[model samples]
Target: MHKLGYFYLPSGKQIALEISESTNKYRYSTNKDKVKFPNIESIIKLFDQTPPFDNSRNLSHFEQIREFTIAKGGRKGFTVYIYECEFNKMKEIKGSPFSKYGDGHESLGLKRGSRVIGRYIDTGKKYKDKYVFSSISLINDN
Candidate 1:
């Protein structure tokens, strides 16, 4: 598994996030096997330079759920489930136009509440009063 990034919990424990082509079942069918993992250094640099939302704290780890939709292109909707590591409160961030229509999170062995690390940018797109990510990657920590 290639180390993609790290998630730092509020308690100061760091979790190493990783990914592997073997875990991706659709790699042979798609170009996923050839796709390079996002640069961890670049992601961290971007995150550090970006300002946090008013009521948002740096995300440690998150849960993801893909809701099926009949909208144009038949793309599924994505909802990020966040539990504030410090506050222990549940919050949600929802959005549409998810690009994965064929093999999705499930194909990567990801479930509704699977622990994941993600990367997002300030695209000025708001989803249900929260910022939406430009892209996210599933962590295959096996």
Candidate 2:
């Protein structure tokens, strides 16, 4: 089992998202507007190739979330955000890519979080404990 990514909401809820390989153009621009969250593929790769969490089981959900976000212009307009998960904070033994993303020393940020919602089951593993957060919609509540 692999642990790719995870999420925690502001309500103190924790979940482990899934990750999967996608073969589609992430970002796209039409004659009308440019997709806000472009390069979703890159983002997935970023999430996948990042580190410690790479082998985690959260990759599938993470990749799915990324796809949904990109399709709906993530972080743009109004988004129906669900649970929020903090990866870097839930550290175990070895260092993880997510933990290093926002260590207050990297260019990412001091704190990194993602919004999602789904059924999560606890695995009780040292670091394999998993959660499932899944849901997709437009940013404008459409």
Candidate 3:
């Protein structure tokens, strides 16, 4: 693995926000009415609502994802947020990722902290322990 990016949010509870790969398109919109938060329903669906019901906890978790990088900004109503997370690519030592599991091979300088429900930066979201964040963004030079 290789360290390619980082996320400002807490370490767990992967976020699946969908944004266009085009930077120009991100800021430029023909429609005057723009929604600040899109795909909110989709984000809500990722939570668990049964037994020990963590709906509120999960919802709060999803909201903590801060704006890592402004993908596009202008005179638009709302700015397009593009967060990046590439901690998985980092090289690990010869041991289990979790200390409780085996010899444990963490703190290789890739992840800032252990996989725990750390409160996200400023957000009160008690994120889970290292949820596999999917559809993470790639650094866009263009």
- Report the number of the highest-TM-score candidate: 3
Question: Per-residue CA lDDT of candidate 3, range 1-142, in tens?
Answer: 0011122322212331223222334566764655343355644443332222233454443332222223322122121111222464422223313323111212223342343313232232222323221122233447
Please give each candidate's TM-score: 0.19, 0.16, 0.23
Candidate 2, residue 108: how far the Cα is off, in Å: 25
lDDT of each: 0.31, 0.30, 0.28
Q: What's the C-alpha lDDT at position 86 in model 3? A: 40
In candidate 2, stretches whose alpha carbon ends up further than 4 angstroms from where it belongs are 1-59, 77-142
TM-score result, candidate 2: 0.16
- What does candidate 1's lDDT look like per residue over 1-142, in tens digits? 1111223221111112222323353356555455444457755654564222221334332311111123222345343322111243223322222344222234334563342323322122333333333333322337
lDDT of 2 by residue, 1-142 (tens): 1232323321112112222211123233433543233245644544454332333444576675565445645544221212223463332212221222123112222233321111222222221232222232212423
User: Best lDDT goes to which candidate?
Assistant: 1
